[model samples]
Target: MSEDPSLHQSHPDIIKRLKRADGHLKSVIEMIEAGRPCLDIAQQLHAVEKAIGQAKKTLIQDHLDHCLEDVVGPLPSDRRRTIDEFKEITKYL
Candidate 1:
């Protein structure tokens, strides 16, 4: 199998954003433990979900630009598989 060129090419900004989101998630957990207001906890959870969606969008864009382009041409099976995987991912969104 050929090495994937985009495997380790994630942008640092994405990593930073993910780290911040992780911190937010931890804070949410702490809020729950501390018996914070239910509405406030729900708001934090919603924010985390939005952050995760944004991160997914960024990753999907990178995949389209790099990994998908690499496997799309001259390989019908690979192309179809990639399309199927993307469709599956969209179901979760």
Candidate 2:
């Protein structure tokens, strides 16, 4: 991490997305306890899964674009280091 204290520009949106997904997940649990139809449960689960996936992807892409750039962009001479950094970041995806 960054020594900077502020959240990244996209972080608020991601947090909102995750919170929405969390609500969806809680509803999913309720639906299951109530013995909802499988198709409906599956659809809600899919939505929750997709929301989380999108949030994760956005965070990683934002990190790669801004954070990694801040860390590596200054060292134009270090090709190998930049490549390694990119590789390291993508490992999570």
Candidate 3:
């Protein structure tokens, strides 16, 4: 299957967010090692989830802006199928 080129595009803000999330995850691991409180660890996990969700939303928006632009022309069927697949894959997010 052809890939969406927009999905491969890099954004500095997204990279920064991902790096922060990585650091948060590392902190979570350290907390667990140090026998930190369960509630505090859970809060960090939640923050990681929220950050990932935000990144996914940004990527989806970018895909719509770039890849979906040509989805309504002559090859509408193919484009619709591709979009349906994209939606299906993104549903788990």
The candidate maximizing TM-score is 2
TM-score ranking from best candidate downward: 2, 1, 3
Sorted by lDDT (best first), the order is 2, 1, 3
- Give candidate 1 misplaced runs (Cα > 4 Å): 1-4, 7-10, 73-93
Q: Give the Cα-based TM-score of candidate 1 against the true structure.
A: 0.66
lDDT of 3 by residue, 1-93 (tens): 236454446455677788899999999999999999999999999999888778777777666656665564445686678866875676566
The TM-score of candidate 2 is 0.75
How much lDDT does each candidate structure score?
0.77, 0.85, 0.76
Candidate 2's residue-wise lDDT over 11-88, tens digit each? 889999999999999999999999999999999999999999999998888777777677666655568576667757
Clashing pairs in 3: none
Over 3-93, each residue of candidate 1 has an lDDT whose tens digit, in order, gives 6565545556678778888999999999999999999999999988888778877777677666665766555785678776874686465
* lDDT accuracy of residue 51 in candidate 1: 82
Each candidate structure's TM-score, on Cα atoms with residue i matched to residue i, is 0.66, 0.75, 0.66
**Whole-model lDDT, model 1:** 0.77
